[model samples]
Target: MSQAPGLGIPGILHTLREYLVFYSGLGLLAGVSLLWSVLALPLRLVLPRRWRKQTGRWVITMGFRMYLRALSIMGACHFDLKALDTLRGESPMIIAPNHPSLLDALMVISRSPNLACIMKSELVDNVFFGAGARLAGYIRNDSLRSMICLAVEDLRRGSHLLLFPEGTRSNRLPIGTVRGSIALIAKEARVPIQTVFIETESAFLTKGWPFFRKPSMPIHYRIRLGQRFDPPTDVRGFTVELERYFQSALAEARLPPLSSMGARAP
Candidate 1:
């Protein structure tokens, strides 16, 4: 009798509602993402090229904030952005973060506000993000040479760049091998290099993880600001050093959940 629902049908209904909230929030996120691209079309036409990108980024930032808030409200997940305040107003720097989950970009972009990233080429034509991303002028990672040149140009123009040194989501625990492109970009742009360590308890949205199966409710995410380095003339050496730095950080970054850690909100 103790294992049965407290109030029979009402208790069962309550349990079902709790289980469905995450799916509902997921649906809302998808709908809003699609709507944003459609609504941004007019803005693209009216604003100048640079202004379009700036305005588009702000719009997307606001949308992402709202999206995160909505999920929080629905008891889906929460974000703990540590040391993110140190990056405020800092520009023309290369932001290198470990790719632990897909939510990493959204979390970082929301906090950085004006930062741009080298996005996948497929996203350039994605129905939900195609037009908006193009208007934002995000670099596509199709051609390495062209992408690096464009990234350096973006930095010179006072725009901060968010680069994932691991290139893609890590398949195993201590992070995967980093690409040399980040070093080349830092070398050519002559900008400061900052590493961000993303720590997560859940494995959802990782390399082969499916979206339908939700991780235990209220999935947690925390990011800590790692070391900052001055640009080095030696690109290859810098890449190797940075890779080792990340390997160590991820290995030792075994932190408790945000609630227990008493982390502050972003």
Candidate 2:
């Protein structure tokens, strides 16, 4: 008797299908990002100094939006945003958010306009985005002292910057720990830090997990902007006060509190 046509097709066909889908998704993401990055380069020279700043911000925002779109398209992940209305058009403010997923930066940038980010040195050196980041003038993560100074100057010039108080992505469920750097920056800049929290259900997109597998679903995010805390005359005193403010805010937000994290006074 002749062997059934379907007898051995399942194994080989399944493997080939998975590989094709995976590589095709990768190629599509890379191609689109390259085009977006190339198109954004000219704005650097065409725009005026003041306009240059805004244009640079737009590039970063667009890059992030593209990244999110690619994720949604390839991984079948849906994006759900909440409480963005509170942050729209707000500037010269220090944005503090709880870091839970790798995509937190993308989400924040995608929603905000003309916002500067405090990024790690490694990302600045990344082949994919280093060129764009340099052109955009993102504050380097190294040299905390210098970064603090730059942040203060940016705020004075009516520019907004984002800071992850945790200083890194959290590994725990609720949140890991918040660094004192944010509190110090708020104090020195004499501005308020807008607190936010993000929550997601997909393990693939969770902190430190970037690989896409098994079509993902829409993930939920919760963003909270707490009442602003004015800077105190004494910078050291202000740091303590601000840290306490964040701790309380986190607690109220139903996330992990930072009181036990031992935030240092400036």
Candidate 3:
């Protein structure tokens, strides 16, 4: 393949466009997150827990939806998330999506209101996300007992729980070891488990992609609803089954060319 400079006008213009979108997208995300955090700080202090959960999560969903729209409008990427809309207003359940990228949770959370997410311990205190997440009543993974209780309580209160089964991004192909938390939560809450597959054609934010590097555009992302498993009686067995299901389902899924992907995962 010819380098951008060698290809002249068209290639140069494409390169320039990619760079522009790349920086703009990252900037928009950081700016919005910071602004939301600042706005949420006061609300968290004033609003009751119930009001905060309702208003905060709804606000987050709309914000993420708009950010995604901006990315689409900017020609940075493409999204096929219509399938998730089908689950709206359905009974409370655990949404389990494959952890391919950091963006996976945002994709799910953006489509629904009042979805309680399990945030990374560090992110719960991150300047960009801490206040917003706390306002939304999102659970943190630092304490297992506390996390499970909070997650179960969220489910019992008619909120969808957004917890990645892989616990983190997949460093291996298909998936990482499926954690038993999903099963434990489902069984304890007596709710169903709705699986989702996030397929992408570029490794822009995968397990080991550089923050400053940009992927070739236009990247395509599609989220498809997978098997809906009822609450299992056996947690260990269910975890084994869930892992197998992901491995089998994603064995032929269209992931990016990860071998040549750049730098470390966030």
Which stretches of candidate 1 lie above 4 Å from their native place? 1-15, 255-266
lDDT against the true structure, each candidate:
0.80, 0.64, 0.89
Question: In candidate 1, where is summed lDDT lowest over 10 consecutive residues?
Answer: 255-264
- Between candidates 1 and 3, which one is better according to TM-score? 3
Candidate 2 on 1-266: residue-level lDDT in tens?
11212436785675555456556755765676566456546766666766666766777687677766765665434566546556777766887777766667878888887677889998877656655665666788799898888777887777778888778866553555556677677777777777676645445445545355432233344555666655546655655665566566555443322222332233
Candidate with top lDDT is: 3
Ranking by TM-score: 3, 1, 2
Cα deviation in Å at residue 56, candidate 2?
1.7
Ranked by lDDT, top first = 3, 1, 2
Find the candidate with the highest TM-score and give its number: 3
Model 3 C-alpha lDDT per residue in residues 139-179, reported as the tens digit of each score: 99999999999999999999999989989888777787899
- Report lDDT (Cα) of residue 21, candidate 1: 80
Question: For residue 148, what is the lDDT in candidate 3?
Answer: 96
Off by over 4 Å in 2: 1-29, 36-48, 66-75, 208-216, 232-266
